[model samples]
Target: MVVATRELPASGYALEVDGRFKAEFATRDGARAGAEELKKRFPMLQVRIYDALTRAREDVQLPRA
Candidate 1:
């Protein structure tokens, strides 16, 4: 099976993975709060909150063979 992924924009506040919106906060502190909110809304898939401002930027793509 091939899974598709997307590289979210720098200013993107949320991500839609497989039709589901993965909420991402603007700051780490905010992300922490968003994490809790996301968990309450969606109890599936692991929610990862990142520091969009300080964290190193990287291109995210689907796994390739």
Candidate 2:
């Protein structure tokens, strides 16, 4: 039996909700915008942006009104 393997893009941004990957974007700004929108809609849920290349995660926090 033969199996095929899939590889992730070398550089891209991903949005994670509650420690699970929700979506991926081509640009960092896009990912940030998505995270912000999700955070606004669900204030109790944890949102973060992950960098595929750097393997880094940044937490998203809402601004105080």
Best by TM-score: 2
Q: For residues 8-65, write the lDDT of model 2, one tens digit per residue.
A: 3356878777877777788898888888988899999999877998999899999999
Backbone clashes, each candidate: 0, 0
- lDDT of all the models against the reference? 0.45, 0.77
Per-candidate TM-scores read 0.40, 0.82
Q: Pick the candidate with the highest lDDT.
A: 2
| Model 1 alpha-carbon drift over 4 Å, by segment | 1-24, 53-65
Each prediction's RMSD over C-alphas, in Å, is: 10.7, 7.0
Runs in model 2 lying further than 4 Å from the true structure: 1-9
lDDT of 2: 0.77
Q: List the residue pairs that clash in candidate 1.
A: none
